[model samples]
Target: MRKWLVRRALAVNVRVKILGIALGVAVFLGGATIVFLRGYLVRVWTEDLRVRAVEIARDNASRSTDFLLTNNLYELYALLRGAVDGNPDVRYAFVLGPDGAVLADTFGPAFPADLLSVSTVRVADDAEIALLQSGHSRLHDVAIPIYDGRVGTLRLAVSEDRMRAQIGEVVAHITLMTGLAAGFGIAAAFLLTYALTQPIAGLLHATEAVGREEFAHRVDVQTTDEFGALGESFNTMIERLGVVERQRTELLKRILTVQEEERSRIAHELHDHTGQELTALLYRVSVVAEAPTLEAARGELIELEKAAARALKEVRLLAFEMRPAALRDLGLAAALQHEARAFTQLYGFAVRCHVAGLGEVALDGESETAVYRIVREALMNTAHHAQANNASVLVQARNHTLVAIVEDDGVGYDADAVLAGPPETRFGLLGMTERARLIGASITFESSPGAGTTVYVEIPIGAGAAEGADDADSSPDSG
Candidate 1:
């Protein structure tokens, strides 16, 4: 049981899925890492920097220049620098006149006239001012305007060096965290997935081995999970299959034995009862014809001879159909050839027979009879419904299988439709099908409306047994 479970867990379907999921997980983590490092984390830091710059500009705007120019340098500087308590992002804050002269600044650089005029505020407008430094230093600076109903131009500016530093630190932290997370997540994912798939794989392999007739194959996957349940299920299935196979083998023996006994009994009746009765009647008729008292009734005597001849022919046919003596006499190959030839001649359709790989051998009675009946039904259907003028038969032994193929170039019928019909329509086809099934063999029939029909039967033959084989043959009536 453990062995079987392991094999089933090794099934191909599970291996393929494991590989696919592993690849998918790798891609997902890789893409997520790229998004976090390249886009989202950087964006978050940039937004934080902008918010801090705006707050500094708002505080410095109101105190330095309101109503009229109230240049309170200490108050404005304190507001801009936040009292200089360890926060460098509030570096330099100041106000600018319309001509770009520095009014009050926490740091000592004259604000550029062109920058103050063209930033966010106009001559009389009160608005936040934003600008980026291009040359010696980097700053994303914002400024605000302070004014009363009489005053016109009062502006404040705050340097953004501290915001840039903070953003850099945040970006570094995010990169490290994302890298470590993706690395650990992907490794764990692959390992867990592979582990999860083992039992299922074992179960699948066990089933495949059983399919290939390796009845001893077992699966062993020890767990309390669903796959463990599946392992138990598979063990049960194999046990059931073994039991069924034993029952089936015994049943086949009994069924074949019974059939052969029945055939033998019928053959004896035809030879002893029916054949002898017809023979006695033929003798009486011949003796009566010879007597001189019936001289004027000569025509009636000829009719009697013809009727006796017909009866004798029918008795022979019945004996052949029951169990052909050639099956035991000349062996399976010759008997089948004889049957095919006779059918062709009688039905007026050309019959071709191909036999190869049928090494000279002998077979048991049951095997011989079973093969003969299957070929007989196949030929009968070809002759009747095939409407074919050209027919061929092939017999061969390959892959330990005895294959017989009968083909006809007739206006073929729908194979599925005919096979699907009620017993009245599909009787012959179903009988042939059942004959193949009684053994461990299979049957296939192919046809279309305009194409020809082909019936194939294949059976396994053992080393010591005589196997009858045939080929794809055409019996074309085309009428």
Candidate 2:
């Protein structure tokens, strides 16, 4: 049942929920106030009615003492009639003799016999009051002694109808005021809900726009509160998302361009180098088959074998350049040494390779490939862009991390300007960054217009082989 109620509440709009809370509070407060005031007014008014009845009875008794003492029956009757006529709340006033006989009563000829027995003044010092029922009305019966009960007792009844009527009027006024207050409270609540939900509605619309890939949508910030902060944060996020989207698009384009360039390079190498070598070997084979003598055929066969070996070597070299077998068989350290030597020969730069405690750190295949590719791309960038004479590659295991550094003594370009430059120029750097990210590694470049560039890649290693690993940079000569 509790879950059902919560779900129902959540299913409604925020405005409805706020209005419900406001209404409930108003109803509860108004109802409680009315009940409390009603009870208070009934108690106070009932007490006041009793006090008034007692006062009138005592005064009538005191005034009638002389008439009773003088045996003036007509004057006593006139006093009782006057008391009844003077006060509208007073229903009747009567006098009883000391022996409990009716002496005078405002009831005239129809004086009730039961009323004579209804009240008696046991203590003569003060008035005694009793509550009585008279048909549809309730009355306070005040009994007081006349002349210390030697003359008679005065009984005066005050009806509660007038007090009840006044209480009704006051309660009606309170209820009407409560209703007006509740109406005003609801109006205020409506305005409050609108103020609160307006920002939320804006956020919802902005989120929908984001879902549609509309990153230009921005929320209006009008206040310095949390809602305003949220709007600002959302706008900032959308701006960042727009930047990331553009970067992703640029990366995809770069990937396609790189693929096409690699394919073209491979096709050119196969055609220009391997194709010529194979064609020469085929010619030598035909020559050996058509030789006239054994000695001539033997020389032709030897030439054919040499040509075939050259063609085979060219094909193998091309295959190795594409994906080196040493990388898979000898691990990342040995593969990097081979790459450094090849780079030195190709770029005409002295490249030094260093490794420290690399064998102790276990790397997954993907991580090894990512690190190797990132280092290779950094070397290629140095060769093409940096006018460097010497370079070095460092692979070290330190503090449960594998760190690789590639540095060159060459004229380096501005790192920030190159990165923020055209996509064509920054594609290599972006590729290196992406490769490092895939391996959960971080890559940084330090470069200036005159200073040499250094690329740093740090990959976290597991604790399995981290113990006893070297925590220092390897010497330039070490591998």
| Top candidate when judged by TM-score against the true structure | 2
lDDT against the true structure, each candidate: 0.66, 0.86
> What TM-scores do the predictions have?
0.40, 0.86
Candidate 2 runs further than 4 Å off? 70-74, 98-103, 106-126, 133-137, 172-188, 279-283, 468-479
Give the TM-score comparing model 1 with the true structure, all chains together.
0.40
How do the residues 214-283 of candidate 2 rate in per-residue lDDT, one tens digit apiece? 9899998888899999999999999999876777789989899878998999899889988888888888
What are the per-residue Cα lDDT tens digits for candidate 1 across 279-353? Answer: 766766766767667663565567666767766676777777667777767667777778777887789887777
Query: Candidate 2 overall Cα lDDT vs. reference?
Result: 0.86
